[model samples]
Target: MEYRITDGIVEAIIESHGAELKSFKLLKNNEEFMWKADPKFWGRTSPVLFPIVGGLKDGKYIYHGITYEMGQHGIARDNEFKVISHEKNKIVFLFESNEETLKDYPFGFKLYMGYSIENSCLSIEYRVENISHEEMYFSIGAHPAFSTPTSENIEFSDYYLEFEKNETASRFPLEGKNISRNTIKFLENSKKIELEEDTFKDDALIFKNLNSKKISLKCKKNTRVVTMDYSEFEYIAFWNKVGAEFVCLEPWNGIADFVDASGRLEEKDGIIKLEGQEKYKAILKIEIQS
Candidate 1:
């Protein structure tokens, strides 16, 4: 089912499947800030990446000496969630491990996702609880696609990403579906990155240890903006389909497997290890400007 929330300034739609955000719009002009999920370019608007952020080596991983096959971004986005709570401006959805999930992921877990709207900003919160006797290993991230060039006259190249602070970071390049060991300098000392069609010719740009927790998508031809604040995440990724009209701003607590990975789930880069009865939480905030 779909739930609607509004704070008089902005309106949003939260869906039960994957507990995903389906739409975000400005009330003043009824202009949509979220992507329309154009299948010609990309079919998903916003998906929750859990258990794994990216792809594993050969779409398989080893856990306790046993091999398990799982697809990219895990099973969360494809599974249905139960509504835990609901209000006019807030909603929460819950997902728990089942026999189906245990086939690929042996550990039992409870995942809670909440969406709340306040004024012009939307806050998304994720909570994971380990419910098994053994230690649980996993990763979680957000994939939110926002429309570029809020104005019709502005071209894709006219938009740019402005970081809250100057960054001297490295971009972890991807080889096929796995992450490569080599990295190249990304931002240098600049605070802004101009967008272009060829910018993602390689793949998504993954960054670690960035100086800023907030970034804004802006256009030179218009005053509208989309800002994302991810203070709790350890890594951030930027991606888009070539020639697509939208960009995904991802904030992750874990990442994909390395090309030379040991096949062990716990050994994957950025994997979170949680003991029995332990819980972890993270938040991502997005604000739309008109």
Candidate 2:
């Protein structure tokens, strides 16, 4: 089912299945942006990461001396979440590992996601519990794609990212996909790039070793803006298609390697493990201004 929660400053639409956040509308000083969720293209505020974020070496991972097959971005993002509790400004959604998930994850676990709106910020909290007798492992993240320039009529090329600091980002070169091993050019100044669908002609620009926590998307004219402070997350991703008005500012706890990885889960970045009956949590918050 779909549910709505609000605290006057912000409003959120959450789906119980998969604990997905369908919409996050920032009510700015008495006006709403009217965020919408398309039933056909509905995606979690950001897709959830679990047993794996991307494909393991050949779609298999080495665990306990055995190999298991997994797909891209795990399965939790599309699953249905159960509404466990709610109040005026907070809502909690839960998902328990089941027989179906076992086919892909092969682990016993419980995932609880909470969405809270207070004033102008939205706080996302994630809790994962190991339900098996032995230890279990996983990864978590947020993928909220916010509308850039805070206006619909503007072209994607009109948007520019403003970093809190003058720090430059480092790009990780992708291999094993017929793509060459070369680092992508990082944006230093406020530059503009035209958006073209089917472009991205190359692979995704992977970034590692970042130290900044805040980034903003604004018009080249600097009239409209939306910002995100992800100081808590280990990394951030900036991506959009050619002509995509929306920009996806992703905050991740981990990332997947090229398809031809060495089939070692431990070697993967940001992989976490929990002892029997233990739990882990990660939180991300977003503040928007118009």
Index of the highest-lDDT prediction: 1
CA lDDT of each prediction against the hidden true structure: 0.91, 0.66
User: For this target, which candidate reaches the highest TM-score against the unseen true structure?
Assistant: 1
Candidate 2 wrong stretches, greater than 4 Å:
28-45, 149-153, 173-182, 185-203
RMSD of each: 1.1, 3.5
TM-scores for all predictions: 0.98, 0.84
Residues 65-163, candidate 1: write the lDDT tens digits.
Answer: 999999999999999999999888888899999999999999999999999999778999999999987899999999999888434677889989999
Off by over 4 Å in 1: 149-152
lDDT of 1: 0.91
Looking at model 2, residue 269 earns an lDDT score of 64
Query: 274, model 2: CA deviation in Å?
Result: 2.0
